[model samples]
Target: MKSKIKAAFNPRTWWPKAKDGMHNMSPLVAFFLLNLFLVWIKTYINYLVNFNLGVTGPIQNFLLVLNPIPTAIMLLSIGLYFRGKLSYWLIWIFNLIQSLWLFANILYYREFTDFLSFGIMGSGSATGNNLGKSIAAIIHPTDYLVFLDLVIILVFLLLRKIKIDRKGIQKRYAILTILLGLILVFVDFGIANVDRDGLLDRSFDNNYIVKYLGLNEYALFNANQTYQQSNTRKKAGPKDLQKIQQFVKENHSPANVSYYGTEKGKNVFVIHLESFQQFLIDYKVDGQEVTPNLNAFYHDQHTKSFDNFYNQVGQGKTSDAEMMQENSLFGLNSGSAMVKYGASNTFESMPGILGQMGYTSAAFHGDVATFWNRNNTYKSFGYNYFFSKEFYPNANKPSYNVGYGLKDKIFLKDTAQYLQQLPQPFYAKLITVTNHYPYDLDKENISFPATKTGDNTVDGYVQTAHYLDQAFGELMDYLKKAGLYDNSMFVLYGDHFGISENHQPAIAQLLGKDKVTDYDLGEFQKVPFMIHSSDLDGGIDHTYGGEIDMMPTLLDLLGVPTNNMTIFGHDLLSAQNPQIVVFRKGGWVTPKYMKYNNHYYDTQTGEELYLSKDKELAKEAKANDAYADKVLSDSDKVITGDLLRFDKRTDFHKVNKKNYDYSKKATLKALKRSQETNPSSVLAKNDGHSTTDEYTTDAPEYSSSSK
Candidate 1:
């Protein structure tokens, strides 16, 4: 019995033993470590291939490299509970899931430029069917390396080179493995916290969460967050709505009568300039205008432009901008509004509100409706029509797209026919995508030489912005030829900043600044907001506001009172209230002072304020900072509580989703009904001929074909 007990704890003669002071690991534990080593290798390869991981510096790479230690220990501890086939298969399945999960995310991130969230994965069969070839095209040959461990293990088992250990690991050893895993986890947390304070709490950006804690931890965090939001919505009280409405009412800014009803009863055309910035309005590269057409539109006699308009975006970026502009509510402080609560939230949106004003609203985009989960969001917005990629011809071809979807020229031109089919005084929005990230262009489409900046992305931005500008020129010509230009309320706005702080050095050359200052970063956030109407007076307004201000401004300009609505933004044209633009991160911009990341700066001088020297400015900054934080918290309470559902506004008409459908049959039926009722309809007057063929451009894809 003594010999047998000795043999149970001893390593086999043929087994490799550790040096002094190191414990001899069991074979099962060794196997788990080996498998996890391969997983680490797979993860490193994935990070290398995935450009959007945006991994920089040695510390980040080191954190990712350290992931396998805790992971292997945890799995081994769990597997030790059973022996033989049960244990073997359990570990195998764990490895399989880990590998496959990474592979799937590699494909998903390539298309969406984001990590796959549990919310999107639960989006059901419609989303799966819509994936199409886009997901498949992004898979790399080396991506198959992730499954190599499975193949090797299968081969060994089939060749009888290895056998499953039937004996369970000793309890002490199993407990040791679990304790080791816990220790490693604590170590990881310490290291991560050293790098970024409250790493888990500041998970508003998924990448930040992944950077400090690791992908596995991020998945768990996301699941918890999603559950919390779901629970919050279920338990919400009517008091939530009362508080929100009261807050908005106290903060409301009455409109300027000068701009009120300026373009009332006119058709509304909202064109979203994707990834565009205000600096490109009249900027030149090598003496060539980068965006001449947009500059011309900005200076046009009837255009109302904002020189100080900022983009208020959170983790959702462009989608967040849409949420703010349409709903007049801030997006969730974390995750995307479109993905997190789009299907469930009760939105008093632009389209739905306009529908009550006898306006038929439609949305146009050249990507799948599920790209940002826009399809369901649009329906909830009470849109009469949604023209996604399915509505455009040849949108699936590679030649028609660069990054996200169809090129601007083709998207706008193809959309012309559908636009004319809408009833008079309709509301339509065109979302452009040519100037998106990793901006690449075909040589034939490139009109200007690349900027001399060393950064390729900066140089590419100049070229792509020019291309989109040229497309805008074609769209203008088409609208004029169709007699829809002068009569419409044309609103063109840049959705967000094209370049981030990482690209600031390259842009510094353009700004003629030796070093990028806080002022420069603040200025970079400015986006163009142009409202053009033929009969209205127009000029640049120096109002400090954000995307949230747009909805109230539009409603006010259309002669609608927003006294009963729940809106977070004040009208830019209203001087009754001080215009304060609150950023998502608790910073704020006001005309007198700018508070950013606990620092106060003078708005006019662009200099940091010394608290001792500028006591008055510091006091104002503290107040503004507190207000900004309150705004973010209040916005979260409203969205998470789904408070709008309890709104008691007598003028508000809740969107009836059952009444809307995006199917071709539904769109055709609506158009047919419009023609039957209104003889003055554009499509009926034109005898159903396509008005898009009139659009002429120098673009290589369409120039010769159309002319």
Candidate 2:
């Protein structure tokens, strides 16, 4: 019976035990246990960070089940070591396999570099913050974990050499391994049960394994709630549709009347200036000017300057700005919306709308069309032609290198030539590319005119801007000479804020201050949006607007009938409400206040704006939260392909067919329909919720109360 029991416990009992058996066992066990713990920790952390655990319960459970492989390997290694035949070659092989597997998994997730960057020091390392360091520390643990494990094995071997037989110790290790294996198997089965019910309604809370694990339950709960909310939006009832329709009907105005321009078959030129900011024009350098041409244009032209305009580019930066401006879609939160959605043929855009109106449409960029996948996006957006670096003659030859493309001068000249060649009444989008990063003009070998003066880098940027300004002047002059100026509309806007700390400092110096208190870190993102035409009546219009509003506003001005399906933007000339600009960085800037995520910043001081008395600030906070929820919900629809179905069903005229002459009959009909459908309007009135009452009247006013 004793022999049988011993045989069951140890298969190696028939073989003679080596002196180093005990010595090898400890190091092997320690290494195995430490690695096992690390693998489990990493798996848990990755699930927490990437996937919402509550929503991905099944996946999480599966990961947990798989988490024991490393540990099992380590345990097997320990048994081999305790067999007194542990080879250095076998240990090296195991280490190599583990290292390669870890690296392979990391690379597969595109996080290998991130892992190595935490003082691990590997090629193509992607360094993050302290979070990365903590993760690395957990993965490797301490040298002692491995050293002690090896030391224990060595100790057993040493003891055995000194005439100590440790047969009982081996029997104890066998029992311990079996117990651990059984425990892990049971845990894996438990996790599997939760995973199996992950998609069920009960799985939301009942089958949420992470909740039991006490790992980021709040985040998991929030994720589940978000998913439910998204489903609610998707499965909106007839009542919800009616509410939306009523909202549009009551707020809607005649497109032409609302946009402040008569409908005509005018050629539209949209220039998206890269990284151009409002401060560039307003800022003065050494008691002089940084952007003399832009300043002069603002002053001399029939300009309507929007003092409260804000930039709302999402994570996609330039592409996001373009998408917001032209597509009338909200900015994306995660990926490049333009690139992702642009490739699909189903996506609708403003250029596509214009193209439907029998106008030739084109997009011009001096850079490669492949950059940001503009070529595919533009084509999908119904552009008949795309002029990129490939279209430029001798573009491969060495010239002044701007940020992402050829010099501004070359881009401007090429764009102008293309525009001149295009058919009349064409919709042309010109994206300029001089004012990008590295801000070094001398490095690019670009020279300015004799009329300009400053340090080479500043002078180079100034010169580049001047060159573009001259190009603009030349284009307008040509149009005038050709008698096309009166029929063409020029819409110019900046893609983003310029990268010039020197310009900011220069502005501060000119103002005789260290920093502009009114300008916050977020304020640097703001750029200019202007619409200029020689034929239209011009005045200073301090209108608050953003990139998303551009398309609807322009479409309205062009006398194109638009529906809610066309855009989220309201007509800038309509009597709608005060404008709000939202950023992907989770902040919004209005005329009176700047709101970050859950916090409001004082517009002037850039400090946290709060109430000294009572819970008035709390009420505002609630409203802000609601606003954020609405915005995010609306944005998510567009990003997640839910909005694509509306493109096919929408007929702009079906919703917008009003009296062209603003007749009372049409107005009365619209009013009656609006009144019948709008329960929210009644609710708002009953609640005394007026836009003017909510915000301070002393805040900077826009030219129109619309947007």
For model 1, residues 1-707, the per-residue Cα lDDT tens digits are 99866755554521334557355665666666677777677776676666334354687677777755676567645776777667766777777877887887777655444566676666533345434444654566887888988899868866866656666566666666677778888888898788657666533456666665666666777788777877898899899888878888888898889888877899999999999999999999888899999999999888889998898876567778898888888876556777777778898999999899888899999888787778888888788899999888868788987777898988888888788888878999999988976677889888987887787657888899999999999999989999899889998888887776545578688688887766677777889998889997888888888888999899889888887888888888887857788877446788877765445678777897766688797688668756776677678777888888888777878998888888877787877788778645577778877676677867677647663
Candidate 1 clash pair list: none
Cα RMSD (Å) between model 1 and the true structure? 5.9
As for candidate 2, its clashing pairs are: 23-153, 23-154, 23-156, 23-157, 24-153, 27-149, 27-150
Please provide TM-scores, in order, for all candidate models, with all chains considered together: 0.78, 0.59
Query: Each candidate's lDDT (Cα)?
Result: 0.77, 0.52
The digit string of per-residue lDDT tens for model 2 on 375-421 reads 66676566766777766764575553445666655555445444544
Model 2 regions lying over 4 Å from their true place? 1-259, 443-483, 500-519, 604-607, 611-617, 646-707
Candidate 1, run of 10 with poorest lDDT? 8-17
Instruction: Give the deviation of candidate 2 from the true structure as CA RMSD.
Output: 16.5
Cα displacement (angstroms), candidate 2, residue 151, comes to 24
Candidate with maximal TM-score: 1
